[model samples]
Target: MANKNHSDGDLKGTFYLVMALGVFIVVVWGLCFGLFLDRF
Candidate 1:
């Protein structure tokens, strides 16, 4: 039972990390795209 709870916590942490990384990527991409439009 203890092990199961620990694994669940690990999974939740992994999920949050992936979500944060995805958001960071989208924000960076948006900034780059905006800069590209400004140049043209």
Candidate 2:
């Protein structure tokens, strides 16, 4: 039971990290796209 709980915690942490990274990338990509469009 302890091992299962630990694994669950790890899974949740990884999920949150991945989600944060995805949002960061999306924001960066949007900013880059906007800058590129502005140049035109």
Candidate 3:
């Protein structure tokens, strides 16, 4: 039972980590795109 709980916690942490990375990538992409548009 303890091992199962640890696995679940790891999975939740991994999911949140992935989500934060995805959001960071998206925000950076949008900022770059906006900067490119400003040049036109």
The models' CA-based lDDT, in order, is 0.96, 0.96, 0.96
- Best candidate per TM-score, number? 3
Residue 3 C-alpha lDDT in model 1: 100
Per-candidate clashes come to: 0, 0, 0
Tell me which residue pairs clash in candidate 2. none
lDDT of 1 by residue, 1-40 (tens): 9999999998998999999999999999999999999995
Number of the candidate with higher TM-score, 2 or 3: 3
* Deviating ranges (above 4 Å) for candidate 2: 1-7
Candidate 3's displacement at residue 18, Å, is: 0.2
TM-score, per-candidate, Cα-based? 0.71, 0.71, 0.73
Measured on C-alpha atoms, candidate 1 has an lDDT of 0.96
Sorted on TM-score, best first, the list reads 3, 2, 1
lDDT for predicted candidate 2 compared with the true structure: 0.96
